[model samples]
Target: MAWYATGTVAVTNGSNVVTGTGTQFITNIKSGDIFIALDNGLLYEVDQIVSATQLTLKREYAGVTNASAVYEIVPTTSNLKTLAQQVTDLIAIYQEIPQSATDAQDAAAAAQGYRDTAKTYQDNAAASASTASGAATTAQGYRDTAKTYQDNAAASASAAATSKSGADTAKSGADSAKAAADASAALAGNWAAQASGTVDGANYSAKYYAMQAAASAASIALPVPITSGGTGATTAAAARTALGVPAIASSNTFSASQTISYSQPLFSINDTSGTGVAVLQFNSNGSMVWQLQKTSASDLNVRRYVSGAFVDVPLSVSNSTGVATLAQRPMFGTATPWDSANLPSVSGRLLNIQVFTSSGTYTPTAGTTKVIVKSVGGGGAGGSTAATSAGQSAVGAGGSSAGYAEVLLTAGFSGVTVTVGAGGTPGAAGANSGNAGGTTSFGTIISCPGGSGGAGGNPSAAAAVNPSAGVVAPTISSGTIINALAGQPAPNALVLVPGSVAISGYGGSGPLGVGGQGRQTTGAGIVGAGYGVGGAGATTSASGAAQIGGAGRQGVLIVYEFA
Candidate 1:
């Protein structure tokens, strides 16, 4: 076969395996066949036929790896010869005939010379025999010499016959080789001619048709016909005309309503000066009635077309800020009560509010442009009252409230770290001071310090005991404060009627929470009621018992996000 190229193949660089797709290697190819890769025009000898779609090459693929590559498999023979090789062999065989013929001629000449020498020796022996009886020995010697010459001649003639036979056999072999070479040439020519079939008229071969197709593609006419899925006209105007569509600037009016929809922006205006305006107008009988205009500043304005001129409607919306201006207030429908809950939210209105009681990262809601942050530090714990003996009394001071701060943050805001302060631990019994509250912060933008703990009360043996001092309010540390306020100080312990009628101080209150009440009898202090509030102090009377202070309330961070 010329070549088996039924399907494509795949090969990897530096690999000996060849994988075929839709190929019939087992049925159409075999070992020792020539494999050619059309991708790189590289040739390889098939080493083994693994399967119908697989084979092995004698050598590894040396070119770039390719998949679904065109290839060919040409059948081969063990002793295949080319035209040059056949001619060379024929010449060699013919050369052998000449050499053999020359050898035969030389042998025949040697034999004739030996025959003449033998005849001369026979004549000399006859002469010697007739001369004398003593010459008889000499004649016999001559005869023996003639006999040796004759034997030599016979041997030479036999050699000539063998040489002649070899020459004839060599000639016949040469003739046969010539005939085989000529037949091979004729067969090759036939195959070549068949591949290059006549290209005249409709009887063109594959190659001829391929060439014609390439030429035609190279010279295709511009502006393909509409039947071929293209506009028949070259220019846009002509094309629109041919499609029976009106031009964008045409004055033709549509008899029926038409809708144009597109996935992308319908159109864009590229204004280099940043001052271009677009307008849409409603007309009746060639006279404009109303018009909507996009101004050079990107603001929208409504206008009424009066007699020979357009008048502004006193209504315009800013595109950059989304702020609207109106000359008159808008009237609301009585059907829906315009309460705070029912009011429609305008642009830049509050979208959501988040309150955090624990430390966490705060992510703004989508489209939030600004956030209002309000933070309060934790409240301080109350002081404990000292234990007293019988007929003695004690009272403790109340804790101070936390600081409060607020800020408005806008621009370049992302994930903000929020930290909520925990409440302070209560003071232990036996005249111990209360623990200070923790600090609250909103990222690095704002921070509020917690309140200080209250002082412990001293045991008094006398009927009149001095009251303990109250706690001070906390301070603000960081932020561009929109509003900041210090917390309220705790109340001092009261000593009415000495040990028997003493009362503990009450805790301080904050913006978000209420303070705890003081104890009047022999008991422990009460805890804070809500966030950012101070705890109440403890008190003891006739019982002379020790009392512990209450814990402070935790701080809070509130975020009001707006667009």
Candidate 2:
């Protein structure tokens, strides 16, 4: 006999069994395999095998366990006639069997092996589907978390970039501060080199360096509070003092670095001709404040102190040499006092006077009167030639000259004569040459006038021929007289009011006369001959030049303090 291998099996009680023609190998079964069946309306599962013919099984009904059951096998037959006959006989015995019982028997026998195998495949498919779903869910969660991390990192990077830019700007400001300090130090060293005095250079140098450091620190926008830097909360005067400024008044609110502007006199000026005065103004904390008037006609610029040194503010103008700037030393403080006891003997000399107080009021002594004389009236032209009918054997008189005088009338001088010199009465226009200007005097003095033109000589008369010389009117004459040689006058002269020495009168234009040899082409009489000059008129002062005028020289103030 050929050896055959067989595996043990346990049959479930409710399962069915059928026989086949070929030997059933049941290849997928293991030692614990079980088969269940219902027979005679009872459930049984083969629990053990003794031999091919007989086996032991457990029987149960309605889910009851541990019932006893025995299995028996018959010899193989082609039609299974023996098993069929047993079933038929049992059915006849139980004539009351229902159709459902018959159908169940038939279906069990037809599909016994296939149903078991199909159930095993279905269960495995369900388990695999559940496992795949879990895996997919887990993968999606990981991806979402990773994306969140990436986005956060990008946001952090952007924030970091912004911070970096801020930091960089702060660093640049620091660098600028450092450079400012270095420049200040170098300036101090240069000052030492140029020092003329035999003082302690080391001490001065140290003071200068300290000031520079403070200023530089203040200029920089430091992140921390600047307790020791240049003045912000502190006043400019305090800062200047701390920086060792020499001899500066403590009452002054400005620093050496700050600009000080001069105020202009309001009422005095030359309507006749010349440059006008512009009030000086200082820029403090980005605002302009009045300073002082220009004493002399000249261009002016602002100066600022940087690191204990004075530097000129950049100025733009034509012909700027000899110009005065704010930072230059010897800034005018106040005016001097007037001394009439020392009356100047010179005819056209000026005597400046100042008021002790800013109000500029003075109670004059009984004998003396003080007033600012703006302009003297023009002297009259001299009389024309005495020749008549083209000079028929007659010599004409020489033309007279004009006179000018400026005086401070005393208290009792109300009787003082005031005569305005008119131009000399023109001679008969046909035969006489133009006459000379007249002399004007207030008291014992006579005013000088313009020189007159000479009479034209006749052809055959053989007489004394007089040639006219161009005359020079007194530059200090009444109606703002002019000298072409003098440039623009000071601020007090052009802008201040009358009766106050604080006010000065402006100089006049070139003398009114014939323009060159073209006598007919002479300009109509006007104050100034230069460009932008205003016509001679009351209340209208000279116009400004392309540049400004010199600062006014300070006046003298003699105070008999009653207080």
Candidate 3:
């Protein structure tokens, strides 16, 4: 039967014979085995084995050297006809040529025996030929399988190369993004740790820290009416008390109202200088016409801000209390009305003014006189720098502070709720933005909401002091001097009812003190300082690393009582 097999490719020189290494199928070939190259299907014979990886060929090979060649061996065949002919000749020679009948007969019998043996040999040769044909068919199947495997291997190699290229590109992009985040974080600092704990076992209220404005007070949501602080609580009252809010008054408070007659030194002294008066009466007709005048002993004189300048005019004073002639009220202040120096002496005041940093109660000293209350709400968190820029740096501005003021004789008894606002925090150096401050109130009378938080150099609808802004803007119900819009930007202050003279010293700047604006590549701006000022946005450079924004400031409260 024919024999054939395959082997793994190996190194070779351009010679008549090729060598291979694998399951040793080629080693089984005999002297007559034939070899065929899988690479080109060139054929050759395996004449002999030199070593495990070497072999000799029957003739000088004509094909290119292929170490992976396979070979087939033709089955051997034997014939007896030729041998019988020689044996018959020998038998004839042995017989006597002269005429011995017995000898001649013996020679003929030996010739017949040789002919039968030769016939047997020829039959065997035919059977071997049929078997070789079957063997060749099987070798053909093996060659086809090896060819398919080689084709698949080539395709796999190509795919692997493409995948490696894509992976390299992805790695490069990731590295650039991480570098940007690291730069911003260096500036943002890990305020997350700063916010939740303090080394001195104290809150920021009475302490000092540079980052206090940059870091936020970590919130520990508390239960209402909470006894003290630890882990968790149950009610809103507990949370309020935990933040230092006064305990809810037992049995509720009484409600009543009365109009305190307005009378002052302006009526008694009657200053004659009419420049920069405290009040400029606003008319519903849209003209800024109201001005004050100095009066004679009986009637007061008045001046008006007309066209563009102040103009002096005659006086007409009117009164409602029947006992007196025309009683006049001071329309404007010599400077700012609430100017601490211009205030009445302590002897004339009911006085129960106290400052609460966190929260407590507003008792008013069991007053028989009226009390003046002023408050500023907490500022918003500073904006944050993004980990990576999606076209532009995403660093936001800081929020503005909220403010409110009112005069309460006995009116604010039910007002003045708790929870003094804490300043906002600097957002993490990533997509994260600034945190918002809390709401503060004098009950129903004064609701000074906290400033809205800032974004990462993105536009935000929550403006710090836009009158339409939810809470950061300031407002007042009493004295003209109290309507100061703290925290507003220069010339853009949020004034309540534009007066001849706007309230001064009201706003304290702070929210992003205006993010770095000179250069596009600058980092975030410093936080605002006083009231209502929004934080500046962050700056981005075409070539520099990302920067972070600043933190928002805290809120405040003040009260003045007059006896």
The most accurate candidate by lDDT is 1
- Assess candidate 2 and give its lDDT: 0.29
Answer with 2 or 3, whichever has the higher lDDT.
3
Ranking by lDDT: 1, 3, 2
TM-score, cand. 2 vs. native: 0.18
- The residue ranges of model 2 lying beyond 4 angstroms of the native Cα positions read 1-369, 372-400, 408-417, 433-439, 443-453, 460-465, 469-563
Candidate 3, residue 365: the lDDT equals 52
Per-residue CA lDDT of candidate 1, range 229-269, in tens?
A: 44555565655555554544433444444443345424343
For model 3, what is the C-alpha lDDT against the true structure? Answer: 0.42
lDDT of 3 by residue, 260-376 (tens): 233431222223563322332433245556444333333333455576355654234432321222222222336332323333333444334455457766656543256656565
In terms of TM-score, the best-performing candidate is: 1
Q: What is the TM-score of each candidate against the true structure?
A: 0.39, 0.18, 0.29
2 versus 3: better TM-score goes to = 3
Angstrom error of the Cα, residue 369, model 2: value is: 4.4
In model 1, state the lDDT of residue 234: 57
What's the lDDT for candidate 1?
Answer: 0.66
Model 2 weakest 10-residue run by lDDT: 514-523
lDDT of each: 0.66, 0.29, 0.42
Ranking by TM-score: 1, 3, 2
